[model samples]
Target: MKATQKGRSPRGILAFVVAMLLLSGSLRLGSIGIAVASSTTDVDPKLGNVEAVSECVTDAETHELMELLKARSEQISALEAEQEKRQIELANAEATILENLSRVEEAETRLSQTIQRVDGASSKDVNKLTSVYESMKPKDAALLFEQMSPDFAAGFLAQMSPSAAAGILSGLTSEKAYTVSVVLAGRNANAPKQ
Candidate 1:
């Protein structure tokens, strides 16, 4: 009996836990009484007829609920992290698309400017060449024409004034003149039929 008195029993520990729970406002005196009455007859004086069964049930349920909440929290955090990663990737993809669009727009602008410059230069060169051919002596122009392919000669002659073209053609060999005339006539052969 002396040894039992010296050591703390399960009942004493249970009474202390109940007291703490009561102070913490987790367990009511009425609930404690119900728990103590069902579990043991020899209730501790300090515990005042409290039951351990209800308190144990409440504690077990609270612990299990906390574990479930922790698991759900972890899952929510993982989902949020995945969502954030995808958002970042989407942003990067959008940025890349915008950059490519900008480059394409720049390429188109440059191409248009280049085309305009080439067209302007070609027109200037054709005008200068036509003037040079028109000012040249007919015999000299015909000599140049003879060296050129019949199609090439016809292209220059077609651009000249009719009288100037006739003068140059009169100096050409009859075969060459006929060939040039044929080429000039067929030049518009592909015109759309009415």
Candidate 2:
């Protein structure tokens, strides 16, 4: 009976250790289940709140970008309007310049016509005076020529016929005729040959 009692005592101690290990394992599993349940309940709302916050940030950024685009668009429109106004001013300035040029051209044309009429009348008067001098007697013409400058007398003689000019030259005093002859000879000395 003592030998059997010793054998049962060892088996009882082994059974006590196995029961404590099973109880500790079950407690750990129960604690792990409670942690998983609590984490799921807390994390779901946190994830939803994070999504909402992300959406709000995206909306703010979009609104800011829209405002920036609107400001830039208005600035561009102002620049375009200023450019158009400058173009209109330039066009007006161009029109004014062209009108002034046209007026200048008209004035120049009128001045030219007036000069032509004056020149024509002067030419006719000179021609009539030359004819009167030619019709006069050589003695009378020479008397008038003696009182004139050498150059002035030479100009009249040059416009007459050769016979009429010779008659007047023959009637002049030798000294006066020589001076007038010198003036007529040299009158065209500076003329261009071409």
Choose the strongest candidate by lDDT.
2
Candidate 2 at residue 34, lDDT? 87
Question: Model 2, 21-127: lDDT tens per residue?
Answer: 99999999999998855654533465564221222235778899988999999999999999999999999999999999999999999999999998999878878
- Tell me the deviation in Å of residue 42 in model 1: 20
Candidate 1: tens digits of C-alpha lDDT, residues 1-194: 56368897778888999999878775577688878576654556896874444333457788999899999999999999999999999999999999999999999999999999999998788878977998999999999998899988888888899988998999999999999999999999999879
- RMSD in angstroms, all models? 14.9, 14.7
Each candidate's TM vs. the true structure?
Answer: 0.56, 0.54
Tell me model 2's lDDT, rounded to 2 decimals. Answer: 0.88
lDDT of 1: 0.87
